[model samples]
Target: MAEPILKVENLKKYFPVRRGLLGALRGEPQRFVRAVDGVSFEVYKQQVFALVGESGCGKTTTGKLVMKLLEPTDGKIYLEGQDVTELRTKEEIKAYRRRVQMIFQDPFSSMNPRFRIYDILEEPLLIHGIGETRAEREELIYKALEMVKITPPEDYVNRFPHMLSGGQRQRVAIARALILNPTFIVADEPVSMLDVSIRAEILELMKELKEKMGVTYLYITHDLSTARYFADWIAVMYLGRIVEMGPAKEVIDNPLHPYTRALLAAVPEPIPERKDVIKEIPIKGEVPSAVNVPPGCRFHPRCVYFKEGLCDKKEPQLVEYSHNHWVECHLAGKI
Candidate 1:
């Protein structure tokens, strides 16, 4: 494989939990929420590497850590061979952020309501000092707007975000992220807030941009089907750790971990001809709290294949089965 454009090794984030007044008076020790714990992955240039899991599974937190939106408790984040986690100065961080961008889940909230579409798109270039003159800024802004298919840029340029539809607003968001011509983008559930009818359109637009602009993406989402369709590589996270990861089709069609199988099973079946097919509930319990994670394998409490003393007593490391397929379950192949 080629060298990764971005890499995260042993990434960890622990948000401290404050104690109540009584607990503080009693001198209780401080607690922490292990939102993201020891997540490691690599994204090669122009590849869409997806992190998929249920809510509170730390996939979003992992994305934020990679984008430098949140500092990690312990880990290393490398962007184009530079360790961004070590960058402390404003100039260093500013230079590093120019190559990395993020498309948030909520399009409405991501953009400022006070600014015109043109201003929103031009802000990045101004901050980066890309366009010196007004004409240059306008040209870049229009080009970016057209890149996302918001044509007749003149009409949309003067208008505010409220005048646009949800789909159009998302396109503007994409344009804003692209105006800087970033090498890598972290799209955190980009299409989750859009209407189902337009979700495919937005996804296809992003895929097109990836090919046309040679931009790699870290697609964070909980939808397994979408991940299977949009990502080149898939990593299934469970309770702050990657339980499984491999090529998209191999992981989706031949899932090895119990948690992965459960996520796949939860996706609504689209086969209308197979109405008689019986579905099995793979997982039984709720996800555990991050502050008080299970002792050993986090999935043991809800896994159907849980063993008496083994799974509950030992934490399994991600082991390779086939060429690139990796799973963290003890019975990966045996089951």
Candidate 2:
């Protein structure tokens, strides 16, 4: 296997929940929302690794941790085998920042309404010191527009955010990220807000860009259907922990973890025979508060196969089931 372009080990992020005046006076223990608790994964060079889970499951939070948008409470982040988490110097961080970029989920909010598309794409080039002059930046911006397939580049370059459609706005976002020629990108649900018809086109464009540009991606989304089409590897996240991960085809075809199976079951299938196989894995009650997570397995409360003593008392470690296939479940081998 190729050496990973990005590696995350025991990554964790916890946001402190402040108490009100009355509660503060009572001296309530400070609580933290465990947004990403001990999550670990790797993205190989030029690979699309999809992080999938329902909302509030910490997929977005994990992405932010990778980009250093939100600093991790614990654990180390390595980029190209360098320990980036320990880079404290201003110059060190500034140099690291240029190699990593993010494409946010909401295109409308991510792009500035005031800035025209040209300025939006040019900003990154200027910030990164990629272009010395206005003419040089404009040339790069036009190339970026063309790369994302925004035709005639010049026409779309002058327009504001409102002049473009949802998909077009997202293309601009992709262009902005690519303007610097970043090695790795964290795409946080990049196509979720777009029209269904245009979703495929955008995904295709991204895949094409990967082939042409050799960019690695941490593709975050709740859409398993898109994961099936795009990701080379899949990691199933549940309540801030990755429950299962493996080759995209193997994991999707033969999901080891119950949570992984449940997620795949939820994906709509066109085949009539396969439709009958989609058994609804009923997760009783809502996701428990992250502030006070359940003991042992975080998923035991909703897992059907959860055994009382073992699952509730002993937290299962992520163990490899086969080459490149891993699962975090007490019943992994037994199942």
Candidate 3:
């Protein structure tokens, strides 16, 4: 196998809890929200590796950490085998930004309503000092738009973000990221904001672009269905840690962790035979607050199969239960 284009080892990001003045004066112990507590994963060239979980599970924070948008409290991030944390100077970070790009969740919010599509797409090129002349940049912008199937770029480029459909705006956002010819892209819920009918179109376009451009991806999403359809590898995150990870097909079909099983059960089934069947979600309760993650197994409070003494007293290490399938749970293989 080829070497990984991106690698993250024990990635962690903790946001310190801000208590009021009285609480602080009282000498209350400081607390932290473990947004991403010890995530580790890798992505090979042109491979789509997905970080999947429900909202507030740290998947998005992991993507932000990889993009260098946020600093890690403790961990290492390597892009193409280079230590990303070592990039300190503005020039060094600028150079790094050119090689890595991000596609945000909300197209409407991520884009400037004031800027025209051409200017929006041109911003990255300007920042990276790409395409010296306006004509040259125009050509590149049109090419990127064409690549994303936005068509005849001249027509759309002249318009503002509000003038386009939700799908079109997202396509423009994708073009903005691709304009840099980045080595890796962090797509954070790229299709979650689009209409259900158009979600597949956008994903298909992204997959096609990945092969065409030879770019790898760190796809962050909560929808297992999309993850199953679009990603080669899937890592199921829970409260800030990966509970189950493996080949997308294997992890979804033969989930080892109770949390992973519960997630799979929640995915809407389309098969006619199972359409009317009432499926019981295995786990209980909403996701716990990150500030006060449960001890031992962070999921024990919500896990249906949690064993009292063993599950509450000891943390489970992520271990391989099968070939290339890693799970973090006391009863991984047994469950």
lDDT (10s digit) by residue, model 2, range 228-268: 89999999998889999998998888888988878877777
Misplaced by over 4 Å in model 3 are: 271-276
Instruction: State each model's CA lDDT, in order.
Output: 0.93, 0.89, 0.93
Structure candidate 1, residue pairs in collision:
none
Give the distance in Å from residue 145's predicted Cα in candidate 1 to where it truly belongs.
0.8
Better of 1 and 2 by lDDT: 1
lDDT of 3 by residue, 69-184 (tens): 98899999999899998889999999999999999999999999999999999999888889989999999999999999998888999999999999999999999999999999
Instruction: State the TM-score for model 3.
Output: 0.98
Worst 10 residues of 3 by lDDT: 268-277
Candidates sorted on TM-score, descending: 3, 1, 2
Query: Which 10-residue span in candidate 2 carries the lowest summed lDDT?
Result: 275-284
